[model samples]
Target: MRAQRDAPVDSMGAEKCMDQDASPEVHRFQVLVSLMLSSQTKDQVTHAAMTKLRSHGLTVENILDTSDEVLGQLIYPVGFWKKKVGYIKKTCEILKKSYDCDIPPSVQEICKLPGVGPKMAHLCMDIGWRKLTGIGVDTHVHRISNRLGWTGRNTKTPEETRVALESWMPEKIWSETNLLLVGFGQQICLPVRPRCAECLNSALCPYGRNPANRSPKKGSPSKIPTKNGS
Candidate 1:
């Protein structure tokens, strides 16, 4: 189903969500690292972990050579840091062995690596490798898409939403969709309250300016009993 585009594209819409300036090679490694750190973690947590990983060395060779325990220690504060450290290390080793110490250029190849799911693969392909072959559906994209009436129904999982959007979203938006919605979700269309009155997409959004307005009514206010003697 098409996301209802009720309003004209904003005058400043093209200026939003600028593509990162990093090279393709750098993007790929960064994507892999970010995806690994992002699982069940907040963006702030992932940023901290990636910052530490950078200090330790970010290349595949460096990651492959590093100890799992050391990696885990550096990536702390990310959810399930200990286990993810092991997974990332194992993934690095696989990359080194299978791809000649280089992160593969193809989404298909990247998907074969340990801990690389479709979401991770799509992210790497878009931002990391610059392939722009697919769309990356994260929590923000999935939630905002449905709220924007792009998905036609409330989807419980990112994968389901991905398949649904991929079928209808034009190929031109394959790469930039996630980034746009991410910035939008973070700044305007928040999970709560949402500041809808000030939102640029309010006119086009099916969920409209205030999701709270649609919530089930509270019935009637309860009155408290008062003592007769005062």
Candidate 2:
């Protein structure tokens, strides 16, 4: 998947924010901020928000110096923008006072920050620090994994799906799994009307094998199995 196309926009956005001449510490700090702004937000929106933030100096000091109203304006349209501003400010304050203005590298320490959860913490560690703490499960991963029978269909949350997947998925693919599955879910295994016929895994997928799982083609007979061996 990495060879097929560029990495997802959030990851790419983080890299874009990292100046070539910037120190490793600065790059990690920028990446952490990017990941924080990305929660419950679309990749393009997150990219735009980061770009706007960068325009005004995307740094822990700059963010803390900015007023909440200005910060909200900069990151407008992101879900819970007001709430996120508070979280970002609190996180920057922690980094400045406790961590000496450097983003913490440990998952436990990162998770202690406001608005930082397992998914965001894991993603920051993986992308910023090149550490594979855990799989970063989002809605796409949770839905697609259940649809593909990779996890129990009853798994109702991304965290549950993450645990179930880690139990069986090979350790080697842990870092790349989220990216690959997220792309697959967006382009092929869509939530409403997946492109099953075009999927490479269609033949091997239980959900894909059942034509009834997909909408019947126009003017075609229903594929749903009937009782009495019809």
Candidate 3:
């Protein structure tokens, strides 16, 4: 799968979704901000939110200086904007106090920040610090991993999926796994009517191979016979 060179881009991935040309400090800050704004938010919307924040000087000191109302307005339309405002502000305060306004390189330290979780911490570590700490699991990663039989069907959370995947997956691919699966999920193994026919892994995917697992097409019959002509 890694050798396939024609993979589609992940529009929602932190690495691809945010500005990549900034200095290390600015890039790290943008990555963290993007991850914070990504929860329950679309990639395009998150990108727009980051762009808006950039216009207002996206830095720890600048964010700390901005009013809560203005910050919330800038990150408007993201899930729980008001709550995120508090998280972002508190995180910036901690960064200023503890890390000299620079994003910490350690996953444990990054996770100590407000609103930053394992997923965000891992992603930041990989994208911002170029350190492969763990597989950054999100909803898409969780769902697609299960569908690909990389994890058990009962794997219920991103954290669980992360554990399952890391148990068997080589450490070398950890950094790129999230983006690859997210792009695959978005383009092929979708939550609704996935483009199974176009998927290279469809032959091995239980969900893709089993017609009964597929969602019924609009205005079409629900049941589909098995390959054995049942």
Candidate 4:
């Protein structure tokens, strides 16, 4: 599915708001909750929902006990809150009955639970269990990796990218790869007018040197601030 050593890798990891003071279990649950909240939603909105959910007690039992109406109200700021509430409630029940009220550590097992697809399962397992069962190909990881010539093709779906990336990226790097790319995606390598000159991996990136980025006049103001300042 992929060739090894296709692209040179740099020290490409980043610690974002997600990694602060969070234990392994909390990180895993945060990944699960974030995946749920991220459906048709932005990261900031999902983070806010998780914050509110945490304040209201975020155990499996507690989450299951939350009424859909209340859950929807609490998560209304995110996209598709009403639908997400039902998925969350159902997922909690599955966790309690199938996994002994604990989130499963296995990526395969986690995928069996409701509302958890391969990408979500991988994210949960990596962050929650610190196990990189597979590469997590979120929008950013997929987009940036392809643009950097790490993968053979650009993909519209996360699953496709996951399968493709697994062939290229070593298991050791899988766990932290998404975290790094997501941060870079959010900050420098954005969808529009990416700050190519300021990108850390600019030297190794194919897209960074492409004509699209070099077309604009020199000394143009950066679309975003530096990571440290921002």
**What is the full ranking by lDDT, best candidate first?**
3, 2, 4, 1
Backbone clashes for every candidate come to: 2, 0, 0, 1
Angstrom error of the Cα, residue 81, model 4: value is: 1.7
Q: What value of lDDT does candidate 3 attain over all alpha carbons?
A: 0.80
Residues 121-148, candidate 2, lDDT per residue (tens digit)?
7888987888888998888888888888
Q: Candidate 2: where are CA atoms >4 Å away?
A: 1-3, 6-17, 216-230
Q: What is the C-alpha lDDT profile of model 4 across 45-89, one tens digit per residue?
A: 676776677777767777777778888877878887777777888
Among residues 3 or more apart in sequence or in different chains, the pairs in candidate 4 whose N, CA or C atoms overlap within 3 Å are 28-128
TM-score winner: 3
Show the lowest summed lDDT stretch of 10 residues, model 4.
1-10
The alpha-carbon root-mean-square deviation between model 4 and the true structure, to one decimal in Å, is 6.3
Q: Which ten residues in a row have the lowest lDDT in candidate 2?
A: 220-229
What stretches of model 3 exceed 4 Å from their correct place?
A: 1-12, 17-21, 214-216, 219-230
Please report, in order, the local distance difference test score of every candidate based on alpha carbons: 0.66, 0.77, 0.80, 0.68
TM match of model 1 to true structure? 0.74
Runs with alpha carbons beyond 4 Å of true place in candidate 1: 1-27, 209-211, 214-230
| Candidate 1 residue lDDT tens string, 154-202 | 8888888998899898999787676667656655565765555555566
- How many Å off is the CA of 130 in candidate 2? 1.6
lDDT of 2: 0.77
**Global CA lDDT computed for model 4:** 0.68
Give the Cα error of residue 184 in candidate 4, in Å: 0.7
